[model samples]
Target: MSGLLQGIRIVELASWTYVPSAGAALSDWGAEVVKIEDTRGGDPCRYLTIGGLDPAQSRVDANFMMELGNHGKRSIGVDIKSERGRDILRRLIERADVFLTNWLPAALERADLSVERIREFNPNVIVARGSGQGSRGPERDRGGFDAASYLARGAVAYALTPPDAEYPVTQTPAFGDLQGGITLAGGIAAALFHRATTGHAPVVDSSLLSQGVWAMAPDIAAADYYGIDRIPVGNAGTAPNPAVNRYRTRDGRWIQLVFLQADRYWKGFCERIGRPDMATDERFVPLANLVANKETATAELRHTFAERDLADWQKILADEPGVWATLASPKEVLSDPQVVANGYLMTVTDAAGREYRTAAAPVQFDETPPPPRRAPEYGEHTEDILLELGFDWDAIIAAKEAGAVL
Candidate 1:
């Protein structure tokens, strides 16, 4: 299928994951996203340090994180602080349908990239801002990363961390940023609809904090209603229902079972475990009996599971009407049969033909996977973009001498 946003134009004045990720998604869906970078070094994410080691230490050659948040977009390096560069941005904004940014409100105003100034160039353009917090608040101008704003402030880390842990669990890299960016992209899509229908261009706001709240809504609601900060989790032996927790297999791998309706699957589960007789035992016969003797039942199940490897259990539960999954590691997921079959990951080839894989946004159109595109090199298309903007070589030379373009 063709891209959903085939002809849409986005001018992105953003760096890092939050706003740039949204630009990537918009570009993925076939928008023309122009990522405006500074004349020096461009986005910092391109040279990201992973776990105190250089990106190449991860054993992947490409700048994968940058590709993750910035692929499928054109890069235009400009010194936005310069008068000539500001004029260049004005020209780009005049032809754009959306102006997207992640700068702090105060910083944007200081840089002359505020909504009011943007409207002076394209009055009908949609202005979208992705921030650490919403535009209005005591900390509006305060800086935030996904770890601080989304996980910590949003209570994600608080809710997910085990009560016995010394510190709250840290979020995986850019986990919240990518999700929030996808959501922001959806908001931009909605804004486009609103503009087309009402001729009233609206300013769209999305934040890491709000995305966290949305993700943890049910947990937040339950915590508030129950007057609790965090709900504790029980292990297999202590779980109220033996079927609702993880158990280790003989091979040291684990499987998670979540049979909420234990009554319906009790006998079938026992049969799959090669212990049909246990289904009729007084200790586990009725659902209530199983709950009363949960520890014993859990022990019995653990013993049974320990008799088999994860592969053996996989075959035993292949067609069973039960809810369970083998715990796959991050590396294992890359070769997961279902993920491969569904095109969840695609190969992205950089300019030098170096290839790496990246996941697609969850949403798809017409069952067609969005084609992956490599991120631009530093100022990859700067001169071509200038030419398209109707600037001559003399102006380019002046901008180059003045350090206006990278």
Candidate 2:
């Protein structure tokens, strides 16, 4: 079967995680994505890395950029600041179904690449823009990263660290950016579907702050009902329940135990852990009592759990009633059997012929599956694309000489 977005074309005039990630998802679903990069440095992410590297190696590799948001897409280097570059982009947009970007409103206005300009060029094109905040917000002009977005809009400051800790560390993995990307992709897809049906394009705008609001909805809703504000509970949840916290195993691996309905599972849990008396104790009988005696209950549970390793606990609780637990770690999750069984990991080759394994797209459709394609080399498709755009070889070379493309 053909992919969901088989005939759709996307022109990505974006950099970094937010907009590129959305384009990548569209590419995975089989849209033809052409990533437009500046002729000089290319995307800024190409230079981002974990450790210092040799210049030669870094330029050839560009590992960080390829890994995050360039998968399943083609790259074209063009100096969009030039008139020829602008003409090239306009030509591409004329044939594109979607134009995705993350430039701020001012930057878009400065570049003359706003949705209005895109619509003037191609009225049937869906314009998707990702921003730090809403376009009309007071802080819209302010720059934001995952950390700032999480702290400001997500209320992450309240529960991001231990209560008594002096400093709170931001979560890595660009949480807000990724969430915003996913949301933007969803909106773009919806808009594309709508356009397909109605023959009218729509603007899809998303923000890191909007994504954060969705992430913290549960806590925010709880805050409205209760007079108390939510605070960091460390490894514990905000459920006001003791059975839903982390427990230390014998080998020091932390296991998360989450039994919200303690009344249904507490007796079985205690019996399984060889603590029958605690199960019948009035102080531990009801949910309120268990929550009230959280400290004592947690200590007892910890002591009981420490008698066995994580594997042992897994075996003991394999089919037990109401006791759901699992060991947590990034490595463990990556190698998990369920993930592998579900085909949540895929392998792709980079420009240098190096094979890199990465996570696959999460969404699934019975008739349309995501395609796996390598991220393109810098300006790898420049000549071919220009030729497709009706530029002859001599014209292409002259354009290159004119610094219209790199």
Candidate 3:
């Protein structure tokens, strides 16, 4: 594979999308990632059928959620409650360069997989922990979900919802979780570099709440200093500058114009729409008057935009513009020329020989991405990994019989 992290090995002991997505990212960069799951059921995300399909109706192919976060990783199921299973984990960690987990401190202690204990096996390993809130405080042990900790507690949900709306809008699937995972991956990469240079094993910690706050730092920072609340501007027409709003064309397509400095392109904009006289009109003469009389300006602009279809408007305003773009949906983005040219999406083949489009990692190397590997099945590499760890066939059989390693 043509990737930057070809020689790195990561031992991941986390479940669900949040942490697993990080492993997927590492795998994208060519790291050898081994996912450790419980023998009982493995990760619950594997069976998730959120889009109206029952688990029993699923096929032997990759599920949507599983493919999104678990691609390019090997899985090994083991009962960490047993001493033999714990030893197996220790051996993996000892041979790995990085150890990642999402289990809380208490859970890690109970399983004897704490960072301190992990260092006993590999002193130079980077210990990375992903959490819901943080590792400290009274609610440290409390379980944290993306919706509760990241979206609600971190003020994302409140900030995005309109003040007059009856209910908060639902966020995109695993929105916060994916961002947190990316943050954790960057932290782990930095820690690995630090350890390589200084010979000091680093403990990297990342939280969903922290990532959420950071994402909305501009609003949160303003609130802290000026006591201002985040008020969602539901209708762009309500904005003081009507020019910086969305307008619908005759074909029902929208063009969002963000003309912060409206005066700069006033004459050109009026000329582009075949309304040069409107530029000199007394009511719309100066920018100050336009702001004061935004409702009238919005009405006039809406009427002007509605006179033509989106394609006609695009051709008319090809050269005359401050800042504008066609409003695009997610499906439209998939076929966008820029997105395609930049290689933002990739095609992958599943176990059932079905090809599907999947997103590539955010960054690229040599102007292209590595071809993705399919996600491994449950315990797909358990026996092979045990054998590589110096276990004989009989020893592996004994461990499997004891319900330690699967």
List runs of model 3 lying over 4 Å from the truth.
Answer: 51-60, 231-237, 275-289, 314-322
TM-score of 2: 0.91
Q: After the best TM-score superposition of candidate 1, give how far the Cα of residue 54 lies from its true spot, in angstroms.
A: 4.5
The best candidate by TM-score is: 1
Residues 260-373 of candidate 1 have per-residue lDDT tens digits of 998899899998889998888999978889989988998898999999999999999998898999999988989999998877777876556667798777677888878878
> How close is every model to the real structure, measured as TM-score?
0.94, 0.91, 0.91
Candidate 2 lDDT, tens digit per residue, 271-371?
Answer: 88789999998889898899888778877888888889889988888888775758668678777897767666666665677765665556666734465
Score residue 395 of candidate 3 by CA lDDT.
92
Q: After superposition, how far is residue 12 of candidate 1 from its true place, in Å?
A: 0.9
Compared with the true structure, the alpha-carbon lDDT of candidate 2 equals: 0.78
Residue 326 of candidate 3: its Cα lDDT?
Answer: 93
Considering lDDT, where higher is better, how would the candidates rank from best to worst? 1, 3, 2
Tell me how many clashing residue pairs each candidate has: 0, 0, 0
Q: Tell me, by lDDT, which candidate is best.
A: 1
TM-score-better candidate, 1 vs 2: 1
